[model samples]
Target chain A: MSNFSVAFRTTGSVTILALNGELDAHTAPELESAIQHCKNEGAYNIIVSGAQLDYISSAGLGVFMAFIEEFRTLGGDIKIAALQPKVFNVFDLLGFPLIFSIAETEEAAVEMFSKGTTHN
Target chain B: MTATIHTLAIPSATRYLKDVRRFILRHARKAQLPDDAIEALQLAVDEACTNIIEHAYGGSTKHKVDIAIIVDPTRVMVRIRDRGQPFDQQSYIAPNVVALTRQGQAGGLGVHIIRKLMDQVEYLSEGRTNEIRLTKYRTH
Candidate 1:
């Protein structure tokens, strides 16, 4: 299997990215590129669905931190949902809950963007 | 379980991190650690290798990082040895995650994750080599 792959689509005004496989240092740049693609297309409100993400490292987490400011400044936010426990623990351990909107389902994440609320 | 040790050396590059993680996971699973513990070990090892590649080697792929996995009945230990720049473990300050997030910083979180996941982390320098040992005890 490929170490990582990203599928992009749009739902309403939100850009939904479905990430599969592992996200580490090597594959992080692919995700960065995907996020940049969204930005170039004028997508600010983004939802990353991690239902297929098997693992993530600090380098992977850094990608989100890198783009969050730009996204939020454009009146949009990056929200994550459907993370496996293994992947979610990494974010939770780093206290990402305080900084990012994380939901249990992709629909909920898109809903949060639509309502313009940070609450997960 | 009988005591066993396995070692691997790879270029200090981010691209090789996947192979490094796979090597550790395969051995960690054979050692029969819990799934969560194996995941934690993989993350911790990846962070350590990344530090060596980025900070120690200055993102140079010419150098090498050596890894050794020591499996015993009660614990699994990972030793990562690098010949890149010497690291000063004593002067290291753990990243303040809250402040980092506030400032929108993307770096400085790798070391913190390593410290949190490993049961014991020891860094030492011997002449030109820098070694980091990470250990996780069996839960059962």
Candidate 2:
């Protein structure tokens, strides 16, 4: 069975990808494809809801790094939200909070996109 | 208590990363490490094994990565051994996260994360064997 899964939902123009389970080198490609799918479908504003995501490693973080620039160049952004403390610590360890928009909840991240804040 | 050593071996493949992480989690818990320390150990070992799979073994599943966890009263040491290309420790430089993202590069962050999370990291290359030892001291 798969150890990770990504589900897609939409809130207006923004597409929300709800990530669940462990995200490691083994499952990172799934997230990459999900983002690519969003971009291919012309959904730019994306919010990654990590409330159910139990774990994350550098490979998982790399997926975000690989795509964030492209989305920003296309006048869109990828915002992360509701990360567990453990997962957030990994992101923070790499100083990702300074680079990406991370909110305490998906609502807050979506609010940032609507307000057009450049960084968080 | 006293020090003890635990070992695990897996094929050098990304799909085995899950098994590696689980092995770390189970052993780290047995070592009585704190929650944060356990998390750090888990991630660090995962990064190391991922590096072994991708760089050392060049994504070849034919190779094997052997892992050993030495649990001491004050620290936990994870030693990973592989018979593949050795990592060039001297030539490695930490990547600028922003610059990497700006260039749309996704990799080159594993070693950095491993360094940041582990209290002590040592890389050894002898003959055809290369080993990386990641240590985390227990906090009380």
Candidate 3:
């Protein structure tokens, strides 16, 4: 059985990807596919909700790095929210907060998109 | 806690990463490691093994990666060994997140994360065997 899964939902123009289970090299491709599916459907504004995500590795982090620019160029950005403290530490260690818009809650992240903030 | 050495051998594939993490978690708990240190060690070791699975073995699952956890009262250390290509440490430059995003690159961040999470990291290659050791000290 796979240890990680991504669920899709939508709020206004934003696509919310609710990530569950562990994200590592083995399961990262699944996330990549999910984001790519979003792109194919022309849904660029994204919010990755980590409320159910138990763990993440560098491979998982790379998925966001790979697609953030593409979405931004399409006039939408990927916003991350609801990361557990332990999961957040990995992102923080890699200085992700400086590059990605990481909000404390899903609603807060959706708010950022609605406010039209470019790099908040 | 008594000092002990534990070992787990798995195929050099991403699918086995969860088993590696579980081994580390079980051993680290037995060693009474602090929660943060355990978490850091888990991530650091995972990064190291991922590198081995991807760069060392070239995504070939036929190879094996042996992970050893050495635990003592003061700290815990992990030694991962493989017979694949050794990583050229000299050529590794720490990645800049903003620059990576601008260029749309996803990889080359594992090494940096390992260095950040572990107190000491060393890479050794002898003939056909390449090993990366990651150590994290317990905080009182």
- The candidate 1 chain A region of ten consecutive residues with least summed lDDT is A111-120
Candidate 1 retains true contacts at a fraction of 0.63
Model 2 Cα shift for residue B130 (angstroms)? 0.6
Candidate 2 docks at the CAPRI level of high
RMSD, one per candidate, in order: 1.6, 1.1, 1.1
lDDT of each: 0.90, 0.92, 0.93
lDDT of 3 at A58: 93
Question: Model 1, range B3-108, lDDT digits (tens) per residue?
Answer: 8999999988888888998999999998889988999999999999999999999998999999999999889999999998877777889987767755677878
Which candidate has the top score in DockQ? 3
Best by lDDT: 3
Q: What is the Cα-based TM-score of model 1?
A: 0.95
After superposition, which runs of candidate 1 have C-alpha atoms over 4 Å from their true positions? none
lDDT of 3 by residue, A1-120 (tens): 999999999989999999999999999999999999999999999999999999999999999999998899999899999999999999999889988999999999999998997774
- Residue-level lDDT of model 2, residues B20-124, one tens digit each, is 888989999988888889888888999999999998888889999999999998899999999999999899999999999888998898999999889999999
